[model samples]
Target: MSAYIAQACTIVHKLIDAGHHISDDDLLLAITAGLPHFYDPFLVSIDTLSDSEYTLELIIP
Candidate 1:
């Protein structure tokens, strides 16, 4: 698996082990939502991408 996928899986596993009943969609959503702050480096490093990437904004506050 790609490093990003592996990292995401690890995060999901940890959350599940901690008793957070998050779905795969939810997990991806959370990551995508947080990516602006959390994955800024990765995003910036990839020059071919545009700002149109998916944003995670549906997360419950």
Candidate 2:
């Protein structure tokens, strides 16, 4: 997780340094939006356990 986050941050930094005009929030949002498609199925399953529970709790509570 840390490595993936670091890689994303590095990519964002590179894009910024190259004058690509991407804001930090925009990069973060794009990354998050694409995460389900990019993540490995096993990892997604593991992450889903917590995320789904939190989402359900938020909706019900």
lDDT of 1 by residue, 11-57 (tens): 88898999989775576555555565666675455434443433233
- Number of the top candidate by TM-score? 2
Worst 10-residue lDDT window, candidate 1? 52-61
Note the residue pairs that clash in candidate 2: none
Whole-model lDDT, candidate 1?
Answer: 0.58
The Cα local distance difference test for each model comes to: 0.58, 0.57
For 4-52, candidate 2 gives per-residue lDDT tens digits of 6667778888998998887654654555555665565744554555533
Q: In candidate 2, residue 51 scores what lDDT?
A: 38
**Which regions of candidate 1 fall more than 4 Å away from where they truly are?**
31-61
